[model samples]
Target chain A: MDKVVKVAVDAMGGDYAPAQTVKGALEALEERKDIKIILVGQEKAINAELNGIGYDKDRLAIVHAEDVITNDEAPVMAIRRKKNSSIVVAMNLVKSGEADAFVSAGSTGAVLVGGQLIVGRIKGIDRPPLAPLIPTGNGVSLLIDCGANVDARPSHLVQFAKMGSVYMENVLGIKNPRVAIVNIGAEEEKGNMLVKETFPLLKNCNDINFIGSIEAREIPGGGADVIVCEAFVGNVILKLYEGLGSTLIGKIKAGLMSTTKSKIGALLCKPALKETLKSFDASRYGGAPMLGLNGLVVKSHGNSSSNEIKNSIIQCITFTEQNINDKIRMHLEEE
Target chain B: MDKVVKVAVDAMGGDYAPAQTVKGALEALEERKDIKIILVGQEKAINAELNGIGYDKDRLAIVHAEDVITNDEAPVMAIRRKKNSSIVVAMNLVKSGEADAFVSAGSTGAVLVGGQLIVGRIKGIDRPPLAPLIPTGNGVSLLIDCGANVDARPSHLVQFAKMGSVYMENVLGIKNPRVAIVNIGAEEEKGNMLVKETFPLLKNCNDINFIGSIEAREIPGGGADVIVCEAFVGNVILKLYEGLGSTLIGKIKAGLMSTTKSKIGALLCKPALKETLKSFDASRYGGAPMLGLNGLVVKSHGNSSSNEIKNSIIQCITFTEQNINDKIRMHLEEE
Candidate 1:
């Protein structure tokens, strides 16, 4: 019998909650028999979506939660007040060791707050960063502290580089992953106060292979396997990356459909173009995992579809199995 | 006879110095007879590139500059010490009122420092920002303080909003241009300390059309005409925008060439695609202008070509003709 990697999923969160979340859970179960999902949300709503889906009843279970945390609500306040909310309940399951991981296609703030407050950070971990796997020209690179730690100090960024390295190496299977601090220029002396302070610290670190400064332009060319920065800079880069990718793709589509001659060209080129574009689709990689936590916490996009959720859940399996948190703790303790 | 706008050109600056700069000056004279260029660089090198170029010699003249500032040198120190360097000499023309503006495709740091230190800031201007006009979907938008004011305060961002508005409206002819402060999230409260502090101040001001917070994703889709942010965020977005644009274009070309059917499609679509792509080319928009200075100082890309140099020189004509600095001073004193 395969050992089950139990996942606690927030079913009442995200733009396409209950339906997409329930369907994604079912699909994940079908794809892998070595997993169990505890869906935490309104029982009636969840069962309505789950009805007639053929799967082992013992493997998939639903735990009823009375409330849903809306995106507009303050994350810390929501987590504190709404104890029975799906996100809070799901995180608690992971905290109690009832589940190995927690996945949510929900409010990023709520997930980040709940992950810290409920699931809790590992011992000696000062601050956990929300590290997302961004798609690059050659492959994916991990962008650490994308939205979590905005006012990060030099010490915090150093830890981000260390944690990000472990995740990229073990889970993503990049050997001796190249870690680079995000800066305005490639030169060590360039950048704002935070960057100038962090550069030498990162360069001097021996636990990871630290490349020098990486300007934002080099990011898409597969410049570094692990890109480290404070949350403010990281968030801007991540959002801009997504925005620019979609805008360009939209422009290309419009260009293809503009003329009759181009329409024929589009028809002939659709298959090849789709395959190439698929390679850059971020959802295929899964959700951003909040590192340095006692139990794994993953935050998916609010508008994620069934595939994204399934991929996110499956990603948790890899994270759990690889013992990423343990490695982070060990890496930190070596000082 | 049209009144000529005198622009001091840094002929020995940029990667294609002397050759492209001299050629571009001649081209600008050919395109616009109302502009006179004073080439500031080594006279021998400038004349060598200008030897065969046929133009009205009265509209083009060379003023010998003994040295050149390299990119690796510290900007402030270089500006003070290298008094006869091409960039410093060109800026001096603007400062002494011998030229209406100075244009350089040399080191960005040198250009920015020289613009402030030599040209000097307007009376009430706290800080002069390097505002670059970036290519967007429908048109171009001005990205203010891209690298100049990293530790910008709330007052600095407000001035950027005002200065950016004047540049977009008077220069780009954008009417009541929408101004937005770049933030991590679209919501009013979501962002780092700088954004949260600056948002409400912009909101209360009746001077410009202050659209609330804009996420980095909305920038490429022409979200706002005057996209305002502190230098660190602005720099990251600008570099990433250029990087991602090229990467996607490369991917699209690769996709079009993958198979025989797509190869024919590529041939059919090449003209239309090139025309569409040309609209988003950053060089066509000219160099970034250091706003709020006594005289205009435009910084073109280091890898600029003859066409970019021509466009940058021509852009100075508009800044001088429109009296942008006088308008900025007037706007500043009103408070």
Candidate 2:
């Protein structure tokens, strides 16, 4: 029998919460027999959602938590006060080795805070970056330090490059993944003082394929496999990527709906267009992992659907089996 | 009779210099009878493009500038060493009070450096921000400090809001334009240190309509009239906005071309689709102006066509007529 990768899921987090989260966990069980899910939330609500779903009863379990965190609540304060909160309880499972990984579609602040304070960071890791895979023209590239570090030092960015490279190479299966620092210009000496400071350090590092500076324009062209920057810029890039994507798509749909002839054309082109668009969807890749943690902590989108949650949970199997933490440890602690 | 606006065109700057620059100048002269232009570049090259163009010769004149600045050259060094470079010569015309404004489609770095060093900043101004009008769902909004002032302070940002508001109100005819600081989250308390420190200052300032904070996701939906951020984050947003716009359009076009039926549909829908896409085309808004300068300096896109160049030149007329510098002085030096 294949070894089970236990995933402690935040059952009360995200928009859909108990319904979509419960459905996603069950779908994961149906897709793969080598996993078990411990749903952490209000037991009554979860059981109500899970009553009719047919699955191996022994594989799926629930750990009741009385409190739920809202998007508006302060993450650190909520985590401290609400010990039985789903996010806190779920993170504790990973900390105690009861689960190999933790997944949440909860408040990003709560997860980031809980992942650090509850699950703990690996030794020698200066900062654990929230690295998400953004879809590019050719493929996906990992955007490291998307939200975790602000006012990041050169050392922090250098570490982001290394950790990002390790994730891209092992998880995404990119060989000797090309890494680049996000900057305003392509030249070595260009960019703010932080980039100028980090450029040489990234260039001299022998372990990773450190390409020079990458402008934001080059990012969508799949210019580099691993894109590194401080949290401030990275967060802007990630959000704008989604914003512009939706805006253009909205414009295109309106364009198609403008004339009757184009409406017929839309009918003929819908399937192929959907397939092509799906290739560019970031959710197909799964949630952003909090790299450098002792085990694993993944933050899915707040409004994720069942498919996204299933993909998020499934990605944990690969992360756990590949030993990404061990690889990050080997790469970052080399000094 | 309307007062004549004198604009010194950098005839040697941009992708299609001498040719598109001369043509755009002629087009502007034809469009408005109350404007005169000084074309600065190699005399022979400027004359070659001007020989065939039919326009009022008195309205369009060429001033010979021997040296040319390339995009690859460093801004400060090139501005200093290339004594007779077109950018420098054209800027000198404004400094000498011969021309009201200077417009270029050449190197952005060169244009920014020349705007500060050559034309000089308005007295009492801390920093001159490069503010560009970006196309939005409703109309256009100004993005200040897109490329200038990377290591910006809160005081500089506060000025940017005031200056941006002044430009929007006078030039674009916007009334008390809403200004927002770019941040990771919308909450006042949530942001990088720069944003956190700057938020309350914006809230307290009674001059502009201060909307608390704007996430990158809200930008494309016409979230605010003046989106504020330091240069690093602003630059990323600007480039990423253009980059993602092109990428999605590319995907959608490919989607339409996948099948024969859709190909016919594309042919039928081409005109309406083009019209829809045209509204979101940022090039229609022309170039970014280096605000707070004594004389106007506008930087058009590097790869701009004649139409874009013409628009860039025409925009200077409105900016000069509105006396943007005088208003900037009043707003920023109010305290």
Candidate 3:
């Protein structure tokens, strides 16, 4: 509680840049006393949004960046060229050990590129996976490699399992989280080549509580605490979860308003239904973290709201306090 | 209306086996005048289930098969060893032109193996894709390669697009269905190695209407009529849709029954809510068809009820009447 964790925020990233980013940082400062934020963007835009916001001057600071990177540009080219951009400057802070972490609601490509290229990878890490917490029936599960590396080798998945375990057990405080590989069938032998090759490696893994293959149907019911997959499959699962949840919820709302009697029922059932559905709302969770990097980098959604940005910034406290990167380094080295 | 479409039903397949399978065949005969079902399973079990049931004997015939290929057995080993198995025998009927189609609520792997090894892939077809019509917001979209042909090459995906187009347009009566490759992002460059290579080939193809990439999020919104992907990605999408749909529906029911006030409201809203939810129920859609095969092969869910089995049988008529195979052959040759 005495020690403070400093996080650098990319104020020029995302759809509502500077405004939402600044507001979110201020909100984080108001909520927690053990965290500090450095907002990186153009001085005029950052100061204009922070004009009237009240916060402890000791906990908040601003660092100006001269350039901005758009989502359309090639990520590698942008990251390499935009040396003074918000994302670049913020990441440089982490790389130089001036900041404990870097948070961005920017172009996913740019963040991923900068996280690996600028911040660099840890000694034993092959690929730094972007792990996100998704809401489930019982609770939340960490889905590793949601949008990081694709066409990942079997060895990459073994590392994902080990790294995911470290995050869930240490950061989330789960006691030996059950790690499951995403598969089409329940059987071990029933998967594509990558899964077939990865299954045995995961089974022999002593660092994690490795469960066997989990079918996609079981994921929503909280079948496992840490779900592992290559980026392509993981990306599909993550996006589909959001899409189908909203679609079904929309259909339910329409059904409730279809008739006069049902409308009356909708009124009575609204509160209880809303209370139950609140747990499944994914925005309550923070952004995905690029694990195995030298320093922490969390990528919030491009369309992130102020609340989401606040949550993303606040979660960095736990990620730092628990010394997650140190634990990951030890676990991976042992493996 | 003019010619009888003969369908061979695997009575010993599925969880319920002869009881549900026999009942489904009878139900299909009652619903349509132009379809004939040849029930292939243990003669005694099928006859026992058929006892005291009134049906036209001319429309339904029994072909006894003593062996049943179970879900646990290796698919290739089972299909090759158990020559008299229901899936193998039923597929043989279609292969010999004795039946227009083969429908089974059996092991998916066995059906996929038998469809290729016994019934054979259509000449020039690299791999036969298992395309299922999934319910979407607007109507239904055909998801190609849901389970079969994992680790697919770029060429296999190109054939899937052609075959899916033929099935959706001819059998489902959609004119020039829009084909979309499933990707994480809308942009062409935003996919794994497989999709990146396949995107331009699809764009260049003139036979089918290629609507670039469709993200998994847009899939449930009826974004595209024909969704194409490799088997692994397609299977995850398919299974997750079933999983998330049911989990949310279950949670909604628990919410509706949480309080006494909500219970009274639930009583008033039950009918309208049920009516709306009925359209989203995937059971109304029949089994997945292994497309680009020489003969029609439908792989129904193992847990299929009589209604689902009946729907599976009834769909074969459309496949036969529209001459789907000839259409697929013509389309593939043009490519």
Candidate 4:
């Protein structure tokens, strides 16, 4: 009865692509009635994978894309040259207003480049930051500029704070999300030049709820709702968070399985332990979004499975429903 | 029988000052015969704490100092004005050749600033870096520039890699230690301008073994012996490493104590679990040394315990014995 929110998905992206992407598309359609998917990839390969999945074709369509972008290819070159590539084609659909959002589980660089060069930025947006929701003990914290703009200025960080606050409030439904700049120390005088310069700017900004500086150690403790930094620092934090979490989980598993006594203990507490660890699993939260863009561009992991893919596709619906880009544009314009 | 390595310790530094510092000095004297300690602090407080502990009085001497640097004081101004501050007095002992090394469980900024201004840099050394040995599953990896100079240039990172390599080989006893730059991606070309520029410089250097770039996710796996980065990135890595380890350990303990069954199992596996977790403790490794200084200056944690302080004091012995600064001078001369 209502206009369908069309999402263009890169079917050829990710490690479990075509099959997982097709399956995810089917799942998204089955779960939501007010959404349509345009699977961009090789026609035959996508069709073969979609044949067995029992889903209504009315909600799904295949857009033929001839090429696939490899992970190692230069982002700018690939975006410029690979016009028919799955990632590029998906972004083109959003650019032409054929789709409301574009989702990819491909090369992070390509998605970021394509998102900017293809779909373009909202007016007054200085630099678009890739903001990801990282799992914390209490709930989730949004880390802006995970790996988009490495050499961001203080004004860029201020925009990140505003946009990150908007994302948390509208899509994730957190009211007055506390925003903080990632820094070496909590003091105003601490951190590098970027942080020192941005601290006062963030404090001065009346648009968002700025909570001041936060050290990396307090991030897992759920101290701030939105943690902002330049891409370089944010990327390091995100990678380290995932690395440390996975490594710790692996060590715990190895410790539990090492001896018979531990094995018995592990078996006894398997259910609860699994639940506890599951709370920290980032994959369940879906992909990071390249914020401040005209249309939604979500970048799922390269090794994303069908479940992660399904969740990422479903995540786009919330962004569309909440009009996140519109809100970002409004916020940017007000400044 | 050999000449004792005299260490000048800031007895008035840290959260648990005089008491913990005196306790550590006593413990170090009892454990090693090859070390003498000059405790710098208020004579009354030092003697009061020292009187409670029995140790070799001849090997332990207290040098009275009236001032103590607070954490909030400006580093440069504090170093300039606080002439007789505990940290400054201790460092002066090293500079005057009365002590081979200086150890401080004090404000990191004061220690760093004093190390540069008082102790001075080794000839040919461009910049001093803070190198901390972090515990890894394989053993320990040297994280250079944990919190020294921030917003570092490519040249500084090159010096870090060289200094870190020297420290790893000489102090840590790693042969031709593999040095790797901390980056977002493994590829040499895939980083910010700083990393990209430093990667080639490190590769061209013939003095130390240089491995390519390493992602932060692979840091815990012991992928590289020496992980080099600018202070900002290095500090983030070090803090996150400590945070994640403590958080995981806390989670494990809480989980084990949750129920009667788990509590009983925890008791059974207590010894093995403790042994496993002990390897990850950052305190066991002691302080981070401000490398490339003419005299050894170690910066212990602000909340360092007696054992950590003792361990740090003992660590300075190895640094002096191995002549790390002289070797750094030789390495820098070649450049």
Top lDDT prediction, candidate number? 3
TM-score of 4: 0.96
Q: Give the CAPRI class of candidate 1.
A: medium
Per-candidate Cα RMSD to the true structure, in Å, reads: 1.4, 1.7, 1.5, 1.9
Candidate 2: segments with Cα more than 4 A from true spot: none
C-alpha DockQ of every model:
0.77, 0.70, 0.82, 0.53
lDDT of 4 by residue, A203-299 (tens): 9988789989888888887879999999988888888888778776776777777777777777666655666677777888888989999999998
True contacts kept of 1: 0.69
Poorest 10 consecutive residues by lDDT, candidate 4 chain A: A267-276
Q: Give per-residue CA lDDT, model 2, range A51-165, as digits (tens).
A: 8768888899999999999889998899999999999999999999999999999999999999889999888888899999999888899999999888999999988998999
Which model scores highest in DockQ? Answer: 3
Native-to-model Cα distance after best TM-score fit, residue A228 in candidate 3, in Å: 1.0
On residues B1-335, what C-alpha lDDT tens digit does candidate 2 reach at each position?
77999999998888888788888888888888889999999999998887765789788888998999998999999999998999999999999999999999988888889989999988877888888887666677788889888889998999899999998899989888999999998787799888888888999898889988888888887899999989988889888878877787788788779888777777777877888889888788888999999899999888777888889899988988899998988877777
What is the descending DockQ order?
3, 1, 2, 4
- Candidate 2 has which clashing residue pairs, if any? none
Q: Write the per-residue lDDT of candidate 3 for residues B1-335, one digit (tens) a residue.
A: 46999999999989998889898899999999999999999999999999998999998999989899999999999999999998888999999999999999999999999999999988899889899988887789999999999999998998899889888888888998999999988888899999999999999998889999998989999999999999989999988988888888889899989999998889988998998888888889989988888999998888889999999999898888888988898877775
Return the lDDT, model 1, position A209.
97
lDDT of each: 0.89, 0.89, 0.91, 0.87
TM-score of chain B of each: 0.98, 0.97, 0.97, 0.98
Q: Against the correct fold, how does model 1 do in TM-score? A: 0.98
Model 3 steric clash pairs: none
Backbone clashes in model 4, listed as residue pairs: none
Q: Estimate each model's TM-score.
A: 0.98, 0.97, 0.97, 0.96
In candidate 1, the residue pairs with backbone N, CA or C atoms under 3 Å apart (3 or more residues apart, or in different chains) clash, namely none
Q: Write the per-residue lDDT of candidate 1 for residues B51-144, one digit (tens) a residue.
A: 7757798888789999999999999999999999999899989989999989899998889899889999998898899999887777788999
